[model samples]
Target chain A: MRELTYREALREAMAEEMERDERVFLMGEEVGHYNGAYKVSEGLLDRFGERRVVDTPIAETGFAGVGIGAAMVGLRPIIEFMTWNFSLCAYDQLVNNAAKLRYMSGGQITLPIVFRGPGGAAHQLAAQHSQAVESLYAYVPGLKVIAPSTPADAKGLLKTAIRDENPVIFIEGEVLYGHKGPVQDEEYQIPLGRGEVKRTGQDVTIVAWSKMVHAALDAATELAKEGIELEVIDPRTLRPLDDRMIFDSVKKTNRCIIVEEGWPFAGLGAEIAYRIMKEGFDYLDAPVVRVTGEDVPMPYAKNLEHEVFPGVEKVVRAVRDVLYS
Target chain B: MDKTLMLSLYRDMIRIRRFEEEAARSYSRGKIGGFLHLYNGQEAVAVGAMSAVEPTDYIVATYRDHGHYLARVGDMNAAMAELFGKADGCAKGRGGSMHYFDVAKRFMGGHAIVGGHVPIAAGIAFASKYRGEPDVTLCFFGEGTANMGAFHEGLSLAALWKLPVIFICENNLYSMGTPLYRTLSVEDVAVRAKGYPMAQEIVNGDDVLEVREVIRHAAKRARTESLPILIEAKTYRFRGHSMSDPAKYRTKEEVKEWMERDPIRLLAERIYALGIANEEQLKAVDEAAKQEVAGAVRFADESPSPDTATLFDDIYYEPEHHEQDEKVVPLEKRRQQASV
Candidate 1:
């Protein structure tokens, strides 16, 4: 095992995948000469040359659509958005074409493409730049939305996404890129749509994904101080939601609290809460509570930003509220 | 044009013309619903251009796609069924007139967004070139789509990458009451191709022979050079934009002037003058085309609607990897491995 940052792991995954498969390639605005805007593809362009590691013009819709078409014709393309915020320009290609082609064509075509980049609120990037889209993409049927919080999960999940037959929106938190974790050296792939329990306990189950998983762990530590032992669950893939795992865990713990970085209204937390009621309501000792980002455009000010986003305090409060109720 | 070919072209043009007319009538009678953009005078463009290309080649068109649909892949019945929202339609009735798609015949789709299909066609052409396939994609769009950013981007990218694509812009003068004069400074739509350094050809779209000859050359050049070509087919729409339009833009005299150049009649006159067939034989060909269309209508009407249970069926690939993963450790055991 080797300790690598999430950014390095992602770059390593892209390089390894490209070396292994001739059909696999990476394309984006700064992916080639600049070595990726966030350095996620630091040494890839020099290693693989320009055709495989293309530096496209500022045409997200054009390149994204090109990748989809390439994927349909047997090339497995990995398209990187500078950030998930810029994906709005390619919404039609992602939503209408990439997501619907297989079904619209009656399963005649398979789009083996991966649209990857940093997602969710980062630093002081306000409003248009700092919105979390986990719930937004998860709502689509034909896409597999995966958000990886750790370096190992980032590498393994990205490899799996590149090899996936369908188009996958691989969301990596921008702040988590510098976070290092133990990753295996050899070929390893974490299966999509599977949930992993970060820390197990018997009192309450906290379901989360991506960066919120880190917050859940922080919340779990604080909640344990008050004698509330919580089990944190990271649903690696959002679309093929691993509800069965959550349901089973909730049934055992008799309590559930969901933490999410997206907006509260119609957020992924809401879906999890609904599922918990539908499947594990009778076993619950308390009603499911949710800690989510405030339903407003993310503000630029630090204090207001902290208030809008879900943090350890909010998760702890929600967990305490659920346990006490 | 040869006597035999002219007669055949005339027959195809008339089939598309009469078929769209029937569709407009049916739509007015509530047999069809949704946005139905009739391509009455535009029949010659679709028939002429489609005839110029090979069967294995691809076609991508705009929302007003019935003429292109009947001319390329499906019969009049499947087209009508699609309009009527029947399961036997090309998209299994999920997509109405605007969203016609036939994968078997390499007819990609009728995308509703103005310039949406442009990049898709370019992508298809790129795929063909990358795969070393000698196939060209013919992307059909109205003059209105030229104003979109996608059109400029797609055309530029196609030319830059040297993709084998022929953009057939059917300039019927009006983009739903907004004429070409109002939308663009340059009257000729072919001038847009100059920005991309692509070869452009302007054809009298109402004359099937002119369109056919131009498309033939354009398709050939696209196939050989792996480059983009543009064809501006200056045609006219005989009907309203859709069923709801009053067609208040132009006078009847203008319509009459364009009708004088009706491609089907022109081709028929030329075929008869060239002694292709007697009047009786020509009538038989016309009757056969109509009968074929009538048979398709019967077939679609008799076909059953798609079952409701199937709505959730094709939404996603049903995780074939699940079965493979099941052979591994269960969730309980996997968690236990975490301890190691």
Candidate 2:
């Protein structure tokens, strides 16, 4: 095993997949010659040639839909939107065509495509660029929404997403691109719809995903000093949620807290809380608490941005609230 | 053109007209549900263009797809059953009329959203080129779709990639009652292609022969160069935009004028004048098409609706290998297993 940064892992995944299949290609704004806005696709143009690693114009809806069509025709297309903010322009293509084509075509067409870009708050980026859409896309019927917190998970999951016969939304956090983790140098796939418990404990279950997973893990480490053992669970895939695993975790822990980096209204945390209440309510010792971003647009100021996003402190508070009150 | 080929186009157009008439009736009688976009007045465009396309070539069309469906596949019964929402339909009743698909015929779909199929058509063409297949993708949409942002993106990408796609625009004067002239600054839809550097042709959609000639040349160009082409078929829709439209936007006199230039009649006259078919033979073709429509209606009426038990099936590809590996570790016990 070797340590790889999230951006390096992403580039590795693209490089490996493109090498494995001639049909696998990268296309996005600045993905080819410019090496990606976030440098996730750096050096791919040199290795895979200009035809495969394509640099697209600033046209999200058109290129995104074209990727879907190409996928339908038997070429695997990895579409990179610069950020989740820009994906809004191509939302119709993502939701209407990419997600629904397989189902609407009665399963005749397989949309083996991945729409990837940075998601959620990246310090002081402000309202237009900082919204999280993991929960929004997960609510749709025909899509796989993935937001991995670790570098190893990002590489493995992206490889799987490119090979998947259905459409997958690969969400990356801008802040976590430089974070490093140990990844095996062998071919592998982490199956979608499985949860990984990062830290095990007995007092509470902290269900989180993406950046919140890291926050929850940090909160667990701090709570350990106080003798409050908190279990932190990361659901990499949101659409095909591991509900049974979640229910079982809640039943064991007896109390639960959900941490999310999105707004409280109709957020992923709300869904988690609802699921725990509906399925494992009798096993709960207290109400399931949610630690989530404030229900307001992220501000440009660093202090205000910190106030908007959930952190270790918020997760720790939520854990104590669920356990005691 | 060969006599057989000319008669085949005429027969397909007649079949589509009769099938759509039945579909419209079925829809009005509460047999079909959801949006029913009729291609009543735009038969010549589909008939003529589809005539030039190889059977293996791909075709993608908009929600107003009944005419395109018939012209492409010549499967009247399935089209009618689809409109009737029967389980035996082309999409197995899941797609209904607005989303008809025939994979074997390479007829991609009846896309609901305006200009939505443009990208898909490009994709199919890209795949064809990737696999070294000489087939082309004929993408059909109305003049109204030209004004959409998707149209610009789809066409631009198709041209930039040099994908073998023929973007067929049926300028039916209106996009569901919003007249094209009112919405688009450039009334001529073909003028939009000036920006893309792709081969473009404008033809009389009222004349099936002219459409045939334009598409034939475009198809040849696409097959040889792998270059995308745009064909703007100047046509009109005789009926209201949908089954529900009162058609208050246009006068009865205008409707009468378009009706006089009916695509089917134009093809019929051309065929008769060329001595391809006598009056008696043309009458037989009309009778046979009517019978085919009646049979399709009967098939749809006799077929059953989809069972609720399987409503969620085919929605996602079934996970073929669901048996978890016996060596998989549970989250709570993963550390213990690792230590062991």
Candidate 3:
């Protein structure tokens, strides 16, 4: 295994997919010439050429729709949103067009396009710049939502997303791009909707995804010092959730603490909590606790920003509460 | 133009008018529900522009899309049945009046959200360009939709990528109850094309010949040069925005003024003036259009309602390729484990 940064893994996935399929192409603002806003698509323009690695104007809805239309006509377009927060400008195209086209057209059209970009609170990027919109897209029936927490998962999940026939909302961790992780030299794909139990334990089940998965793992390590073993699970795909994994983990641990960077109300964790309660009601020793970002919009102040989103401290507290309640 | 072409345009415009009239009647009788935006005075914009494009070209229309659908040779019975909420409708009754779709004809859809379909139209054009196909997409929207962010986004992308798309803005002067002038800063929608740096033209929407000539050139340019164009067809609606509209926004004099330039009447007059058809032949065309509409109504009345058993079908295309991994337990297995 060779170590690669999350950014490099993403570029490799895209470049490999483009070489394999002529229909596959990348288009977004600053994707070409400028390399990429985040340099995730670096050197792709020169390799794939300007036509395949297109640089689009700062029109999210326009290019998003263009990707959808191209997918309808048999082109697999990878549309990048500089960040998921900017995706709100193209929300209509994502929810109204890309999400509903298949159902509205009676399945005559398949929008095999990936709307991917960095998401969630990163550093001190204020309210507009920091938003975790996975719950919003996952709510739609026609969309497949995936969040990759590591370089290997990023590469594998992205490849699967580009090949999938349904519209995929690939939300990447803005903070994890620089994190180095082991990535296979050969090509491989991680199936969507399969949860991976990163660490096996017995006292409590800690569920998270994307950047929060690392936080949960850290929380488990901290709780381990106190002689409490926490099983950490990363649900790579959110929409077609791996209920069996979550339920089985909860059934064994009999207590669960869910963590995410999205807002508390109606968030992905909320749905997971509901599903766990509905199915594992009798197995629970205590109520399932949720550690989530504050309901208010993200603030700019460093201290307040850190307080707004969940971290290892919040996850640890939630686990303690669930275990001791 | 050839006599046959002139007569055919006249016939298509008449067919749209009569079809809309029948739709209005059906709405009045409570046979059609939801919003029914009739395309009465704007028939020439659809008929004329659609006639210029090849059969393979795509069409993306707004809620008021009956004319666009019929102009692209969409099935009359299916269109009427869709309005009637029958299973035989174009969208299988799932999409009422505002969401007619026919994949076989390459008529993309009838999007109800104002200005929402503009980007999708650009996407269709991008797809065609990506495949090296000569297909051009005609996207129709109202003057009101011109002020939307999507209109700007869509047009900018179309021009930036030089995608083969013709943005046809049917400036009927009113967006629902609000006048176009109130919403848009510019009097002519074509002026906005300067922002996108795309070629644009304003055409007499009531004159079929002028619209056809302009759209023909625009479509040809899109295919040969990969250039997108904006055509603001100055037109008006004869009736209210929808079945529920009281139309108190404008005066009767204003409606009457536009009615004087009615597209169907203008085409009929042109047919007669060019000696393409006599009064008897024009009368025969009108009669035949009325009969065709009557037959559509009959077919809709005979069609059955959609089967409730398959309500969830077509929500997603589940091919064999999407088979679940063996490692991932199914929902039923999870439920069984929970019971234990």
Candidate 4:
């Protein structure tokens, strides 16, 4: 296993895929010439040339729909949004065109396209940039959503997404690009809709995803010091969620707390908690709890931003309440 | 210049006219639901423009799309069945009237959102250019789409990349009920293309020959040079925006004036003037269109509604193996798995 930063792993997956398939191309703002806004696509322009590694002007709706159209005609296109917040400009393209083309065409048109970008809060970027939109996309019936929290999952899942025959929404962590972790050197793909237990225990299950997975593991470590063993489940794929893994964890632990960076209402945490209580009702010892960001637009103040976020302390306190000890 | 080509174009325009007329009759009879966009006076734009391009070239159109489908595929049963929401329809009843698709024919889709299909049309052309294919893509939409962000972006990208897509704006002078005077800042739609700095042309959409000639030149540039061009087809929609629209906003005189230049009549007159078709021969074309539309209505009447058992199909492609056929789980599978 070779350790690589999340950004490097993603680049390797793309570079390898492009070398393997001529039909595959990367198109986005600053993805070329500028070596990617975050250097995620660094050195790709030189390797693939301008034809495959295209750089478009700042028009998300334009390029996003272009990618869908290309996919409709037997091309695999990866459309980057720079940031998920900017994806709102291309919402109609995503929701109307990409999400519904296959279903609307009655399967005559299959969009083998990926809409990937960084999401969730990063530092004090504040209200507009610091939002999580996985739930909004997950609620749509046709899209497959993935939010990989680690370098390995990021590479494996993105490789799988590029080769998938459906439109995929790949949400990369806004802050986890530089995080280093071990990834397999050989070609491999992790099947979507699968969850990984980063750290397992039996006292209580702490389910999370993306950046929250790191927080859940931190919470687990602190809880372990207090002799409150915790099971941390990271649902890499948000849509077609790996709920069976979460349910199996809950069936073992008999108690659960969902941690999320998104708002509490109608968020991924709410949906996961509802599923746990619905199917694993008999297995529950207490009500399923959710430790999520407060129900407000992200604030600018660093302290207020931290207060809005669900940190390790919130997860620890949520465990004690769910445990009633 | 072929007599058969001229007559076939004439016959195809009549077919779309008759097909939509029958669809309207069915809608009034409560056979069809949802939004029904009728292409009454704009038949020549589809027939004429489609005729100018090769069959292998891609085509994308707006929601008033039955004309484009008939001009491209012309399977009345699928077209009428789609309006009736039947399983045998082009999109297997999932798309209904607004989403007819024929990938085999390369008639990409019947997109409903205003200017949404413009960029998609460019993307199809993008693929052709990327693959070094000489194929061109024809994109048709209304004058109203010119005001949307997607329209500008699509045109801008096409010009920037020199994609082989011909953007034809059928400037029918109305955005639904809002006239161009009310919605557009500069009423000349072709002038907007100047900003994209692409080659452009304008044609009288009512005159099928003129529309055909203009598109022929544009398509040639697209195929040979991989360049995009914008064309404004000055036309009109005889009926209201959709089945629900009363069209009371327009004066009877305005509607009556545009009807005099009706696309179907203009082509019929041209056929007679050229002596390519006579009263009996042209009458026979209309007669055949009437019979075909009648049969389509019958087919739609006899077709079955899509089964509830497979409602979940086509949401996503779930392939069982690398070279294996993709499987679509039944719609109930999601609900079934959710309960567990």
Candidate 5:
């Protein structure tokens, strides 16, 4: 096993995929000459050259549609949004063309493209810059949404997303880029729509994804000291969710708590809570509680920003409430 | 011009005119649904531009794209079937009149979104250049689309990358109801090309020959030099924007004025002046077009609706693989097994 930061793992996944397939190219604002806005694509331009590692203008709608068009003609394009927030500019291309082309074309066309970027609250980037849009993308029927929470998962899931013969929305946590963890040295791939249990317990289940996976893990550790065992599940892929794994965990633990960085209204956790109530209600000892970000524009101040979104304390409290009930 | 070429162009334009008339009738009769933007007056632009490109070249158009699809695919039956939402339609009825796609003919699609398809056209052109293919992509949109951010972005990328794409702006005097002058700051849509440093031209969209000549030049530049060109075709839609629009925004005199310079009548006059054919021959061509359109309607009426079971199909590729749940032990169970 080799240790790599989340940033390095993403770079490796892209670099390896580009080498494996000539059609695979990376295009985005500041992705080439600037290495990357967050340097997640560092050294790719030098290795893959300007052809594959393309630096585009600050036109998300333009470049995102360009990627879709390229994919329409048998090319695999990896479009990087500077951040998920900027992806709003290209929402039509992502939601309309890329998603509907296959279905509209009656299977005559396939859009093998990936729209990936840092998402959710990052420091005090404020309202416009900080948004968790995975739920918005997951609502579309033709899209495949993946939110990887760790370095290994990032590498594995990204590779899988690029190879998948459809439009995929790959959401990377803005804060998790620096987190280092063990990744396999050999070539590997993690299947999309699979949930992985980071820590297993019996009293309660904590289901989280992306950056919230770390929060759930921390809460699990803190709860262990208090003799409250908790099972932590990371749903790597959001759209084709591993529903069985989540239901099984909730049934076994007899209680469930969902944590997310998005707002509570119609958020990922809201959907999960609905599913748990619908399918796993018979085995549940208590109601499924959701720990989500406050329903306000993220604040610029550090303290307010921290309070806006979910964290370790929030996850722990939600788990405690479910366990106690 | 050669008599055969002149007659061919006339036939194409007349075919479009008849097809649009039929589509309008269908809409009026409650056979068609959704927003139907008819290309009644803008036939010359689609016919002329499509004539310049090869069969292998790609084409993308806006919601009012029946003419473009007919020009590219030359399949009147399929086009009508698509409007009828029949399974045998170009898009298998999944895409209504607004989205007519024929991958075999290289007609990308007719996107209903105002300016959304511009970048897609550029990207298709980018793929052509990347793959060393000689194919060029032609993107057609209304003047209203020029005001969208996608227009700027798509043009900038196409110009910057020197992608092989020809952008045609059919300035049909109005975008739905907003007049071009009211919406766009510039008089000539081609003037916006300066921002991208791309070559551009303004052509009389009523003159099919002039439109064809300009598109031919643009297509040549795109293929040989890998340069993108924008051409603004001054045209107008004879009917209201859609079936629902009464078009009271413009005066009856304005409609009459545009009708006087109708694209089909202009081409018919040109054919007569060139001694290609007389009024009788032109009348025969018009008659043929009517028959062709009638046949198309019959085909559409006979075609079956798409199977209900296929409603969920084509949404994703190999969805079965994604549906399967993987077997895995819980973290504690794995740890316990490792300890044993």
Candidate 6:
């Protein structure tokens, strides 16, 4: 076992997969010569050569469709959107072409492609650049969505996404890129649709994913002093959720709190809360509450941005509300 | 072109013309639904260009794709059944008229969005070049598609990469009721290739031989040199954009004028002018094409609609990543919940 940042873990997984399979290639803006905007693809061009680690112009729709077309034949393409915010430029290719091609073609095409990049708010970058679009992607039927919290999970899930037989939307944590954790040296893959119980307890359940997972863990640390003993769950795969883990936890805790960074209205949190209500309705001692970003399009100022985003305090207050009510 | 090649091209144009005519009849009778874009006037471009390339070469077309499929795959039953919305269709009835796909034939399928498939076609060529394959990709769209960013991006990348993709813009005058003069910034779409530093050609689509020769050279250049090219096939549609429209935008004189240069008739005149075939033989070719289309109609009429029970199938190509014990709600339970 060795320590690696989330960025290094992703680079390792891609480099390893490229070594294993010749068909796997990376293509995106600044992925090659520039060593990636965030250095996520640092030194890949030197190692894999310009052919595999391709660099494209500032054209998302073009390159995205190119990846889809390549996938249609035999090549497996890793189409990187520099940031998930920039992905809106090529949303048509992802939503219409990539997602629907498999079904629209009546299962004739096997799309082995991954659309990966950093998502969610980062520092002072406001409005356009700050967005967690997992819900929008998850709503599409033909796509599998994955958002990993830990470096280990990021590496493992990314490897799985590359090898998967369909279109995968791999949303990496924007702020968690530099976060370090121990990763195994041996080859491994974390299966999609599986959730991990990051920390277990019986008093209340706090479910989260990606950046929000850290906030939930922090909230649990503070709540434990008050004998709350909050159980933390991270459903790594957003779409085909690890439902059994969430339901089992809810049944035990008898109270649930969903934590997410996306907009509160029609967000992934709404779906998770409704599912808890449906499946664990009888077991619940209190109502399932959601700790999510404010409904407004993220504001600019640091304090207002802080107020809009979900944090440890919000999760703690949500836990208290579910417990007290 | 030789006599055999000339006759085949003539016959191919008639095949598409008759198929579209019959499909239009079926639509009038309330058989097919959704968009039904007929390639009535643009027959020469598909038949002529598809003739120049190998079947292994890829073909990606826009929503008005019946002609491209007929020219490349030439499965009249499959194409007609696709329009009929039957399970026996090329895309298993999922794609409808707008999206006709035959992956096995390397006909990448029909895309509905005006310029959306351009990049997909470029990507197909990108894959071919990456794999060291000589197969080129022919991307088909209308003049109206030139306005889309996707089209420019597709061309720009293809040229920059020196990928083997030929963008064939069938400038059929009207882009869904709006004429090119209104929709396009420039009257000629081929010159736009200058932006990409790509080779360009403008062909009189009524002349099947010229189209065949242009694509032949373009495909050769693409295959050997891996160069992208933009080809504007100056053509027009005889019918409205789709089955729904009355085509009130154009004057009867204009429609009548373009119809006189119809590729089917133009090719027949060429055949007769070259003394390749007599009037009776050309008439026989037309009759045979009509009969072939009539048979396809009968086959489509007898085919079954897709089963509602299997509606949920093919949404994803399931991967063996996990033995989901409870990850997914069972279909039966989901159905029950939906009812509730």
Index of the highest-TM-score prediction:
4
Off by over 4 Å in 6: B319-340
Residue A12, model 4: lDDT of 94
Q: Candidate 2's error at B117, in angstroms?
A: 2.0
Best of the two (2, 4) by TM-score: 4
- Candidate 5 lDDT, tens digit per residue, B110-194? 8988889999999999999988999999999999999999989999999999999999999988888989778889999999999
Candidate 2: tens digits of C-alpha lDDT, residues B51-88: 88899899998988888888888788888887777787
The residue pairs that clash in candidate 5, if any, are: none
- Structure candidate 6, residue pairs in collision: none
Ranking by TM-score: 4, 6, 5, 2, 3, 1
Give lDDT tens digits, candidate 3, residues A15-103: 99999999999999899999999999999999989889999888888888888888877899999999999999899888988888877
Give a tens-digit lDDT track for model 4, residues B1-340: 6799889999999999888898889999999999999999999899998899999999998888999999998899988888889999999999988999998999899999999999999999999999999999999999999999999999999999999999999999889999999999986899998988998888998988888899999999889988999999999999999999999988999999999989888878888888998989989989999999999989988999997755666778765422332455465774574332
Task: Please give, for residues B22-74, the per-residue lDDT of candidate 6 as tens digits.
Answer: 98889989898988989899999999999999999999998888999999999
Q: Candidate 2 DockQ category?
A: acceptable
The TM-score obtained by model 6 is 0.97
Q: State each candidate's clash count.
A: 0, 0, 2, 1, 0, 0
CAPRI quality level assigned to candidate 4 from its DockQ score: medium
Off by over 4 Å in 5: B319-340
Order of quality (DockQ):
4, 6, 3, 5, 2, 1
Q: Taking the tens digit of each residue's C-alpha lDDT, what string does model 4 give over A138-219?
A: 9888899999999999999999999999899999998999999999988999999998999989999988999999998998
Residue B328 in model 5: lDDT: 41
Model 1 over residues A1-325: C-alpha lDDT tens digits?
A: 8999999999888988999998898988899999889999998988999768888788877778778767766788899999999998888888888888776655556788999999999988999999788888888878989999899999999999988888999999999999999999888999888989999989989998888999999888887787878998898888778888999899899999998888888888888888789878799989899888888998899999989989998888887787784
Q: Score the docking of each candidate (DockQ).
A: 0.32, 0.46, 0.62, 0.76, 0.51, 0.67
| DockQ top scorer | 4
Q: Write the per-residue lDDT of candidate 1 for residues B1-340, one digit (tens) a residue.
A: 4766677677777787767777777777887787889898888899888889999999988889888888897467777777777877877777788888786788887888888668778878877876789999999999998898778777887888899999999999999988888998788889999988899989999888888899999889999988898889999998778889989888999999998877777777777787877788878888877787777667766877765544544455556533544354554654432211
- Each prediction's whole-model lDDT (CA): 0.84, 0.85, 0.89, 0.91, 0.91, 0.91
Candidate 3 lDDT over residue span B188-293, tens digit each = 9999999879999999999888999999999999999999999999999988988889899899999999999888788777777878888899999999999999
What proportion of true contacts does candidate 6 retain?
A: 0.79
Per-residue accuracy of model 2 over A1-325 as CA lDDT, tens digit each: 9999999998899898999999898889999888889999999999988878888888898888878888887799999999988999988888888877776776677778899999998877789999998888887877889999999899989998888888899999889999999999887888888888888889999888888889988888898998999888888888778777788888899998888888889887787788789888799999888888999988899888888889988887787787673
lDDT of 5 at A20: 98
